[model samples]
Target: MLKTFRWAFAVTGLGLVAGVLYDGWTALGLVAVLAVLEVSLSFDNAVINAGILKKLNAFWQRIFLTVGILIAVFGMRLLFPVVIVSVTARLSPPQAVHLALTDKARYQELVTDAHPSIAAFGGMFLLMIFLDFVLEDRETKWLGPVERPLARLGRIDMLSVCVALGVLLVTATTFAVHAHQHGGGHADKAQTVLVSGIAGLITYLIVSGLSDFFERRLADEEAGGHAGQHSEDAGTGRPAVALAGRAAFFTFLYLEVLDASFSFDGVIGAFAITNDIVLMALGLGIGAMYVRSLTVYLVRQGTLDDYVYLEHGAHYAIGALALILLVSIRYEINDIVTGLIGVAFISASFSSSVRHNRAARR
Candidate 1:
């Protein structure tokens, strides 16, 4: 209660101070706005995370909040953009850094210009999520036998890799064919886009797949240990440990993936706001904290279970995010607009969930 509030404030304060020191008042304001937008847009994400978190053991929960923070802050915030700049923009590593730091204005323009591709990535990604959800909802008999197979294949996590690859291929071909039309001096631009897209997809696949495998293995071990202890207890009267370790591990992994997915839009969007790398990082980092805290709050409150349609809303948001990303490949999407769209859908779902709960009570 008080302790948690204190901790949250302390963490936020630290982030603000750091942001101010790094980039001053303008940076701080950006951080504040981004934080609000992220939190609002990701309420559904928090609800979904809460449902998963309930299944995890306490140990893994702590790891998720701590280590997961590091990954989000450093990995997604710093490294992700650099990778994008190098791979997509054809800037050498050093040159990219220089552009981000010194030529902040131009760098931001470049990032904004890249939104169509980002939107494309997200749009395709969300489509897979939406399709999978549609197939899984037994109550709504949409696809039947065909639905089941596609549902099985389109498990959002698994299908994301293929979608990403597809996006890369399409982007590569489009860039190659349109290069001359765009005033084609840089022959390597198409190659860079192709390579970067492939790299991003590969990175997503490896990280997500390995995380899933490790979680499954941990779960199996925990199950076996529980069973062994149960048998021993029957003969020797020993208490058995719970077999939920693996579940927790997997939940953590899922949360990480979710975080990564959410951050992609933020990182790209932040660039549109400011090219000052430090400012962009500070602003987005603050936004990350709000999203993280909101996620924890949703878990603590049992928001997902209490609001049944919340998960549905989140999946829907995922669908929208996918669409937004796809569109971004060709247009500049304002973060405010993106955040509002997700928030609106989630809010509607939440209201529906509340109504259903009341009806159930009656």
Candidate 2:
């Protein structure tokens, strides 16, 4: 475990030293708190990431560690907020960057202004993931009672989509009525949430559909070339490996989108601590690196196989997060509460798995 986290520790040490030098002990403490907050909020994200990472080939795995980390750290944590502020505030990206540096309070305000839409998009996307997982027929059942019933419902055409759309409609209607009651204030917020939610759903469909298409093509090609060849590398049965170059590309894209969906809440919650973008980026970047490292470690250690219910717990946590994100659009939930929900689910699942293992041994 120490070996796996050696780099994370090193990075944290350097960040703390830099933080202390830059702004004295307070900055150092803030960075430490932010990093810990990010890690706690994102532990389930690492588990889900590990589940996906196990399916990719070696080269793609390396890309996830290298290129993917870059995206998670810089692209999402730093550039993403800038892009959001720029687009929403009608400023250029460079101008947004300037604002972030020179006028952080205002920059934080702009980002907060955009949170309704961000929450809508991210929440819907994550909701679809959880719904699809629950609704799918799986050979291995973790929470069989809940899952079996959901799988039965999955037999209905587009049931997951239907459920998501219904929830979105209710959310929009509720908010729209609320805004109207408040003298038509924030009337546009409902529209923004609806549009953003649809956009997220569309993005998920397109990415997952493209990935499936490419994966099928690759499987066909492999079958034609080599008889008795498996689509996945010989291992514990997950989904078939997406082996074709194009398929791998799409799969990587899907993974990035998935990660982004998981990040929306954490990014917004960080604002409660401080409005300094530089500090937020640096602290969150350190946490993101540790999450990525944890993903790799989980995959390499076959932790998912050992803790069979862990992935199920993570997915359920995603479900909880999706709902929480949507609700947070109107009602404020403490970040600590959000983090605890994930932790609680994961803890319960881990405990259940241990009991199962013990019973099997007996």
Candidate 3:
């Protein structure tokens, strides 16, 4: 683990020094706090990434480590918020950068003002992932009491979609009511929220659907038979060879989208610690690197197979996170509360797995 995370440690050390050099001890402290916040909030993200990464080809795995890191650190953490401020505040990208540098308060306000749409979109996308995982009938049952019933309900086609849409509608309506009470006197905010939520749902469907389609094609190519003939081998549960070409491409895209969903909370939450975009990027970017390294480490170590319920824990954490994101649209939730809920669920699942392992040993 030390070897795997050596770069993370190094980068974090450098970031702290740079923070101090850039400002002072206060800046360094804030950067450190932001990094810890990101790491705490995203441990489950690493687990989920490993679950997907293990199925990818080694070449693709390398890309995730290399190219994926760039996207995560620079693309999402730095450029994304700038772009959000640009579009929302009607400024060019360069002007957005200037605003971020010249007027941190205005930049932060713009980003925060855009939070509702971001929350709605990310919430819907993540909700779909959790629902699909729990609602699928799988051979392994981590939390059978909860998962078994959900799996049975998965029989209803597109039930997750229906549930997500219903939830979005209710949430949006609640927001509208609150807006009226506050005298915003406009439905545009609610409209934007609904549209963004639908876009997220659509994005999830496209990415996941394409990934599933390509995975089947690749599996068939390897098995030399009709697609789905070797369904079990297609999943990460079984030993599998690397996917080629198009399959690898789609899988990579899927991973990026998944990472984006996980990042939404971190990006928004970072403002709570400090509104300095550069600091936010530096701190969160350091944590992002660690999360990526953790993903690769988990894949290499085969942690999922050893701790059978770990993936269950990660998925359940995701479910909780999704719910939290949705609820945040209606009420303000502290980032710490979000982090603790995820930790609680994942820790319980881990404990359950340990007990299961001990019993089997006997």
Give TM-scores for every candidate, taking all chains together and pairing residue i with residue i.
0.75, 0.91, 0.92
**Residue-by-residue lDDT tens digits, candidate 1, 163-224:** 55666567656644354323333345455555545544554555546656766755555576
Ranking by TM-score: 3, 2, 1
lDDT of 1 at 162: 61
lDDT of 3: 0.86
Query: Could you tell which candidate, 1 or 2, scores higher by lDDT?
Result: 2
Error of 2 at 191 (Å): 0.8
The number of clashing residue pairs in model 3 is 0
TM-score of 2: 0.91
Stretches of model 1 off by over 4 angstroms after superposition: 1-5, 89-95, 113-117, 120-122, 138-251
The alpha-carbon RMSD values of the candidates against the true structure, listed in the order shown, are 5.3, 4.4, 4.5
For residues 136-215, what per-residue lDDT tens digits would candidate 2 score against the true structure?
99987888888899899999989999999998888777753353222225557788889999999999999988988888
Q: Between which residue pairs do clashes occur in model 2?
A: none
- Cα lDDT listed for each candidate: 0.63, 0.85, 0.86
Which numbered prediction scores highest in TM-score against the true structure? 3
